[model samples]
Structures are given as C-alpha cells and as structure tokens.
Target: MKTRWIWVLLMTASAAQAEEPLGCVEVTVGGYKAPNYDCLSQQMGNNPEGAAAAQKNMEAMNVPVHKRPPNQLGLATPAATSTRMGNTFGTSVKPQRPPN
Candidate 1:
C-alpha cells in the first residue's frame, strides 16, 4: 500500500510539471523590448504564423532607438570609430611637460 501511494504521488508530480506553461523570454533590440519569437512559438505550441504575427505586433508598438529623431543636442548619432585601438591605462593620461 505504501509503494502504491508513492507511485501515485510521483505520477501526480509529473502531471503537475507537464501542465506548467513554457517560460517566455523578452529581449532588447535597438533599445526596443520584444518577446523572443522562439520562446513565444514554443508557448503557442510551435505555431509559426501566430508567433510571427505576435512579433510583428510587438515591433509595431515601439519605434527602435535608431529610428527616433535626433536629440536636442544632436547627440543621437553614435560616434564613428576609425581605429580599433581603445584608450589603455598608459595612454589615458598625457605625460606632464618636464618642468617647462
């Protein structure tokens, strides 16, 4: 009888786990937050069309960071980096002129 009860409890636990919904995740792109399509599709039972429509609706709701108008100081545009070398500790400070 104890063994049978243990089996029943295990089965019930597995059933509860199976009924739990899949975890959906969101991602930020171009300063816009959108639901992850792969996760959404899984949550929607792998329905590609439904996931696509949902993604479209989510994207339509917000303008991406790049598309927004420039700020008042025109600093919205990112600075261009022609050289890959970044400022290291040695180069960060200029050497003081020798007691000029």
Candidate 2:
C-alpha cells in the first residue's frame, strides 16, 4: 500500500511537469524606436572616459536595459517602464523616422 502511494505521487509529479506542450509565443515591436543608441552614446559624452565607459558597462552587463524606475538599491536609474524576453526574430528593417 505504501509503495502504491509512492508510485501515485511520482506519477502525479511527472504529469505536472508535462502539463504544457511548450509552444512558443512571440511579441512583436510593430515599429518602435525612441531612444537611439548611437545618439545616446553621443549624448552620454562621446570620449574615452565617458562614451567608452558607457559602452563597456553596457556590453559587460549584456546590452543596456531600460528600467521602469531607478532601482531602490541605487544600482541603476529609471528609464523604460517595461521589459520582456525571448528571441526578437525578424528581418533587417530600414525604418524611417518622421520629424519629432
């Protein structure tokens, strides 16, 4: 009887893990471009001690992430209000920006 209970529990755990077939979902950025990297680098202070540091820091942390708000720990400042993950698969797009 104890063995039966154990087997039942094991099967339950295994089935729980297999609940989803693991399909993929993609989020498309229809046409988003606001904070430009090239321009940002220039604005941040384009030079050895300025732009270089920013570039290195960005790369070190694996691309700059826009924060919704400055971290309470004071590690980073607030910028973008949201974030997401997964592959951004798409073709090369040459988008145009109108007068702002």
Candidate 3:
C-alpha cells in the first residue's frame, strides 16, 4: 500500500511537469542565462540594468520589438487618410499645398 502511494505521487509529479509548457530553449541574453526568452525578459524588465542588458541582447540579435501602449496591444487597424498621396509627377496638374 505504501509503495502504491509513492508510485502515485511520483506519477502525479511527472504529469504536472509534463503539463508545463515545453519547447523552452535555454538562452543567455545580455549575460543573463534563463530557461527561455520569456522568463529572461520578464526578470530583466524588473530593473534598469537588466532592461538595458535585454535591449542590448535584442539589438545584437537584430530582433528588436517595440514596446506597445496598453490600448494598442490588440490587433489594430490604421485610420483612413482623407487623401491618398499618389504620384505627383504622374498627374498633369501640379498639386499645391494650402497655407494654414
């Protein structure tokens, strides 16, 4: 009975670990080593030094991501412009800017 309980506990522990997100690659960015980029970024974001290091790592890798505003986090559609700036030289009449 005791062996059965131990086996059950071990199985449960293994299952829990298996349920965790996989495919996490070990990365050393900005001299900080972590299991994955997400963890590294989150930890690094806590301090100015870490943030700078993370940014440096990102720049070195040439994969910089711009920080987005909270409101702009979701999928966004661009606002429509009143006039499309078509080729100016293509038109016969030259366009003139109106003074404010």
Candidate 4:
C-alpha cells in the first residue's frame, strides 16, 4: 500500500509538471522566442533559408540569450583542435562567441 501511494504521488507530480505550462510568453509550452531581430537576421545571412526558419523559431522562443547572436559559424579553430585532442573550452577555437 505504501509503495502504491508513493508511485501515485510521483505520477501525480510528474503529471502536474508536464501539464502545467510555463514560459515568459503568454502562450503554450516553448511558445516564446528571442527578442533580437537583427541577430537572427545576421545568423540567417550565413544559413540562407534555414536561417529564416530558425529566426522564426527563436522569435517564438522569446528567450533573452536566444535573442542574441548564435554565431553558427565556428569560433576558434585552435580551440576546436584542442577540444578534439582533449576536453576543454579553451581559446584554441578561433571564434568562440557568435559573429559580431
């Protein structure tokens, strides 16, 4: 009986979390997007059609960081090489942050 109750409680909690929608937007789950239009536009410059779709998604996401440039382009080549050799977020990579 105790085990059953525990399972029921866990299930209920999970259900609540799943059902309870959350977001900075006033829509459903993951409904918000980034606020930066130019950032998305810049990123789109590199990706083409895909960038447009991504921009829409980001806009819908409404996240602060997402609003910023994603810099899809590689950062530091050296850093990437170093990472390949080991496990670190070093400066070996040429471009770390998104394109300015």
Measured by lDDT, the strongest candidate is 1
Model 3 residue-pair collision total: 0
Candidate 3 lDDT over 24-65, as tens digits, reads 578788998767678556555557787678888988776424
Cand. 3 Cα-lDDT: 0.61
Worst 10 residues of 4 by lDDT: 20-29
Off by over 4 Å in 4: 22-100
Give the alpha carbon lDDT tens digit for every residue of 17-86 in model 4. Answer: 7762332332345876445555455554656678689889998777576454544344446555665546
Ranking by TM-score: 1, 3, 4, 2
Candidate 2 TM-score versus the reference: 0.21
lDDT by residue (tens digit), candidate 1, 33-63 = 9987776766767666977898999998777
Backbone clashes under 3 angstroms, per model:
0, 0, 0, 21
Q: Name model 3 segments beyond 4 Å from true.
A: 22-35, 38-100
Q: List the residue pairs that clash in candidate 3.
A: none
Task: State the lDDT of candidate 2 residue by residue for 1-100, as single tens digits.
Answer: 9999999999999999877433333344667544445545554553568767787888776634563235643553323222211122132233333449
Off by over 4 Å in 2: 21-100
Q: What is the TM-score of each candidate against the true structure?
A: 0.28, 0.21, 0.25, 0.22
Question: CA lDDT of each candidate?
Answer: 0.66, 0.53, 0.61, 0.60
Candidate RMSDs in Å, in order, are: 16.5, 25.5, 16.0, 22.7
